[model samples]
Target chain A: MTEAQTYSFFLGCVMPNRFPNLEASIRKVLPKLGVQLEDLEGASCCPAPGVIRSFDEPTWLALASRNLALAEMSGHDLITGCNGCYGTFKDALAVIHEHPDRLKEVKKVFKGMGLKFDGKVEAKHVIEVISELGPDYIRERVTRPIKGIKVGVHYGCHLLKPSKNRPWEQTQKHTFLDELVEATGAESAKYKDKNLCCGAGGGVRGSQVTVSVDIAKEKLDNLIEAGVDCIVDVCSFCHLQYEESQEQLNKELGEKKYQIPVLYYTQLLGLAMGLDPTELGLDKHVVNTQPLLDKIQD
Target chain B: MTDSISRETIDSKDIDPEFVDEIVKAGADRIRTCIQCGTCSSVCPSGRRTAFRTRELMRKALLGLKDEVLSSHDLWLCATCYTCLERCPRQIKVTDAIIIMRNMAVDHGFMLPEHRKASQKLLSTGHAVPIDDANREMRKDLGLEELPPTTHSNRKALDQVQEIMKRTGFKDLIEGEKMEGN
Candidate 1:
């Protein structure tokens, strides 16, 4: 087999702090599929959904630009596990790409920090990379198919928005993640508000808890009502929000209510690639994947 | 009942006199450069969903109509996706303004019901919601041999987060239990 594609992984804020398993799962499986994930030195948060944007817009852009600079300086395009980071990085690039004046200002801010981004490095979410690898490549790598499983895919806002200069081009004719999910032998289903916020946005979870949870609850209800066995997310924040928020809502409602497990797309792929559940950080997710696990036929 | 606040921009001098300077100094100095450009609103996920316009919020904050800016439901609708902040031609920090307004709202006790309920849950449980119980029960019913474990927090993470919040000037935003009813 040809050597795996090597990439510099950007495990944005939520993954490190709340969804460590996402990085852990991708690390476990990518090697098996001949993909090498190199760690970028001293990478900080993409500062997407985490940083307050309005009050310190330049600072926020400067921080994201700093991350892009790291990858550019290292001579590797940045790959992120979180959808939010993908959006933020792409948005930053778009800003610098569209306006020379703004680019100059942002570049000046980065210059003081000893970084220069010549815009050579591009940002991509894991799904985009998988899509580029194509379904045939993915299917060939799968040693164990996650059969008998139905997955509700939550693409999250950042993964699918602004409709201009997407991190990965969308043809208005293609469904990337859904195709990849099916390649692993699991059914990729959609729910209402498939593109809705997980209510984890805007640093809302820390500041505006109820609205955040309510937003999460909306996602949960839609996924449950759609009758999927589990929900899979590309964003760590959405994964945590759906998993944790659903549990809290069920408790308040006083019943087992919606018991759908939430999975990182990497975890599901890792399982298909024959990595053990323990190795994939399945044991660490807030949402129980026991239902989906039972269906794994391991 | 208070009269509806107008979105009109009165003369900068007629407004709180210090309002424009204060907002500019708060790091949103680009408010005046907004040009009523709908770039922010057009790109915002929340704005696309619920007409949550950040430009208007900036206008209000710039005018120092603090009450109107903080009390509006628009700030609550922001998803913090940063699409607006990223798209703003003038580079206005729209999401940060919403956060500042939310902080202001918490101070004035205008926090909507959504903020109140979730805060209580997060405070009582380290998690915003307890997922452990569901996992235990679901594993049992599914006849799984082992349940996935919950990641333990040593309070350091929480403390670190609190320290950041304190430093950011929202130290008491959570509103202590003693002050719950009062």
Candidate 2:
């Protein structure tokens, strides 16, 4: 029989609550592309940059390995929406794949949880899979083309950093997101500081708010400086930091020189795929996407 | 009590005690293994931007310069992108060190009030910060809808967070906040 067309979806922390719209959009859009997101019961945070940073190596190894093992058990490839989840799983797999000794240690940690990870499963960021699936196929599947919507692309830190196993390599010049957005007939905004971080990293916001804001401010200021209509990103954490920090920074800067809505690329993709604003959960983000919705609806 | 206090306290004449050692013994046990290779420093984007140095922070932590590590803004400068942890030769969890320092600072009342205010907002509202009115107007101007619904406030969600934190001993670590009262 043909292999099942389903995937074990890993919705890391923040998606269910902080950015429910992004999740909704993904769920609404993926099915149209013939991808079925299989549910895995009882999955926890990737504990990335969080537990991994704070705990012993074995603890982090076991924690991330446990997440991978969950996907492995579900008999479908592990597909995640969060950038941190993607990075943690890919990083753990790389570590275990490269070091036999480390794999043994991870296995020992898993054994304690009465689990064993043979490292056979594949971990993919949602965007990586989409990019691999080819923009042409994506374009053909689009029921709605987001014409006239000018969008700024935020590739995020984890996905862009390390750049290992990046599905496409453009040595001279490449904008993976811009290319994809254009495939939907949307205009990719030309923004300076298009690559700055959202400062959600290092668990900084959770521990040190001042630092986190300081970091996010740099990115927001840059995007505003560029004059983008809206910010679109693949990582929910980046989406959260950028969306929330833009509002906070506007207050701090004492003038509303910039106010841009944040969209998980999936939500934007959902729109391009002809999904309705309500179906994509656009009403749910604290940053508000009403303006974008109106533009699309109009 | 005076003798015990004197023994525990350092005078102006004493060398700066190894504060990093104290933290390591206090469960940040990965300090001594750091190799100070500068891999973390070079790889850090913020370090590249602001001269933030994780290697220097690790060195200070290794030397037990508690006051130096906690007071210096370097720890705050990290974005926690995990680049250092990925590239570290000795596999030092540089970002985790920063978190530990922040918690220690907050516990000691060294935290900025703004940071505390934000945390309170998160604790109460299940969000890190509030949305500004201008942002609301901007969203309307952009034709997007109002704030979306959330799955954060439910007992199941909160309980799940607590359970995970418990599993990771993260609650106990942050619970160190209470020790500040003493």
Candidate 3:
């Protein structure tokens, strides 16, 4: 399939609600780089792959198909900032392609609603789009590197899972996300369990909060032990876990606060592009960033 | 929380003859193919802290231990992080397979309450995590629109989401369960 030069932006539930700044940064950075982020207007949730899909496969397909139909109507590929939304769109796209009977079932439902999902629209993540922008394009464009800042990269599971489905780097020895982190001149700090999750997927954080916080607490401990200044992630769900769970982690552990700030890759990229950190929404972060920002070479 | 629970000692009556096929029909087509390598279990992030052994779960699914697999709280312990799926040597699609089991569990009227609340929120608001006032101020701070062009801002689109939910019985399936909250 020939990749389209322009794509519709698929903003899932979290970005619009919990982290609008991340959305603002993506909008500010990508257009300047020549990637058009068309609004996927009237789009609903990706219906949350882990939660909704777990209960009923056909229901999940119908919901996902509705969003894909919206994107297919727009004549551009869908580019999502969230991994769960990406996984849902790509997984639904894959199932329909692999199973005609399923597609027929989903289409019959769409027919009742006067919409169509032709499976022509490809669901691309913003990270993959940046990588496709090529390393040199990013390197040459860097106007101000927040040089010497160590970034702990969190590649959320949904972004690169079921290896058969996603378009990101190969699971083994993956550096696709890392390479993008370095494009800003901030080193991708080596942390144990870097490939592990932020412990907030599959509705676990909502249902099993203790278990979810336990897993993230370990990952953060590992991150801090690695001496990284901040966390950089491509998916907002992981950002939510890493950013929101720290307060809970400190409460549960009865320990000193884990105050590491979480930044989406686009915010880091915006800083490298010489965009004001306030315009990138850095000041609105849940965790403190003053010490981390102080260390940046500016 | 996990220390008190012990692995079930399987007996002949524990096996439901059709349970394996039922799982396959649910989309985990390769459950019987697991070689018990313990690779999936070792790499599972949830497995390390919780009793959710991916290898053991597959063994139960293959052995047709329906009562043991569905009735245990350990069933819901997987974070669906796909770490096991990434690490699975057999390429079992472990996370998806676990979700298939969860669908079966939901059918049997077994589900965590927190998940049910989220499902209810999705049905009602069209967004699973609906917008709150704090986020509204944050959006204003970023000089963007208060609400995204989503169901939260559009009623007709939300009705479309509910229509899909109703047509698919997702509303009933999620709301039908009366499990006590975890």
Candidate 4:
């Protein structure tokens, strides 16, 4: 009976470029949950916090503020599906607010473009929006409950770090994600070092993929040990790492050691909503998601 | 009968005393408050499998070992997950400090080649990972626009992004002098 919550969807590079299925999943699922997405036209990258910010803080803030300014023009808060992009916008805003001088510099850069950022708009992760809607709201919409699937929830970094800026209370251990996962009637498995980094952030993946995969191997090992059907992640970058690392490990080891499917949270939630798996882009994953699909169908 | 052990010690002359202040000014205001606590390193996921020691890196930065700290590849190994920042008893912005140190490292020409390529991509296209023909095709097949109304589909928007990069010196940072190896 109420109007849909409208947000300017900030699509970072990874999802739309490398993994369009994650983009597909978000676009397909959110509308069914009473959320309407508006494209932030002509928006660039989140500029990526790890790489860009590491090189030059001022440039990072300038680029991020430009994105924020675009969302302000639309008169809506921006919501991103990637943790990296979410981190960049949130961290940039925090820096600008905390240091007025930096905001002044950002505003100076904007002067030439006829853009202004009053810090009126904010950035949120897709998880934050869905979770804020509460599990009960999501629970009511489930047409097909995936009661038997056990999931390893990977709460990739940047979703809950620098706790002072985030809405969540506890950083180390949090159940908001787990609660959402359970809402689909799936068990959110307890795995070792559940909150560990996916090893792809901070430019490590681009710089040294071998090291990044090695770090991911640890998390994958823990998830495999926990006997989960698949790895459900909120970040597209982390999703890429899990899917790519499994394939990379198999290639390097010359064995099919890892085959666990990686799903963005929406893809999993879409299945519970009885949305077609192909429509959600489950067929696009590197690791086979059929086993999870078959289990849910059973 | 000679001892096989070789020891390397830092020379006082190599220490840049103002390096700590440089990082602090860059916005890691709590770098001086570190008490040699290994909490950051201990919680680091990368430290377990790699040679990255977060606490030791912080210690070196605090000691003003500018050359040693800035030139080390270990600086890039941090995943920037902020677990250390969350757990730091001193409430230090440990990860932010590391990121600032990376910026300083890049300023001194110690950038990774991959990062240089990525920055160049951002300069050229509005997105770091720009849309390609394959993704374009996939997007259409997925019932969405080939280009999702971003800078890819908007020329003026892309130009605006490029202009911001130019004004911020990001374009120069990527296109300027050849940076040193990582």
Best candidate (score: TM-score): 4
Candidate 1's C-alpha runs over 4 A off are A1-4, A110-113, A168-174, B1-67, B70-73, B80-182
> In candidate 3, how many Å is residue A269 off?
0.5
Best by DockQ: 4
Over the stretch B17-116, how does candidate 3's per-residue lDDT look in tens digits?
7998987886777667789999988988888898778898989888888988887787788878787877776777778778888888887788777777
lDDT of 2 by residue, B33-76 (tens): 87677898886767755767778888766666677666666666
True contacts kept of 1: 0.11
lDDT of 2 by residue, A1-298 (tens): 1155578887665665456567667777777777788764545556454433333344445556766777787677788888777877876787788777877876654443545477888887788778877789888977878877888888876786545534448331358778887788778888766666677775566666666777777667777777666788898888878878877777888987556888888788888877777777677676768887778767
lDDT (tens digit, per residue) of candidate 4 on A1-298: 1124888999989899889999999999999988899999889998898999999888888989999998888888898999999999998988878888888988888886878688878788999999999999999999899888899999988898888888897546899999999999999999999988999999999998988999999999999899999989999899989999999999999999999999999999999999999999998789998988988888
Which ranges of candidate 2 are over 4 A from the true structure?
Answer: A1-5, A50-52, A110-114, A165-174, A253-255, B1-51, B54-73, B82-182
Error of 2 at A123 (Å): 1.1
Model 4 chain A worst lDDT window (10 residues): A1-10
Best-fitting candidate, measured by lDDT? 4
B74-123 per-residue lDDT for model 1 (tens digits)? 76778766567656888777654565556556666666554555443333
Best-to-worst ranking by lDDT:
4, 3, 1, 2
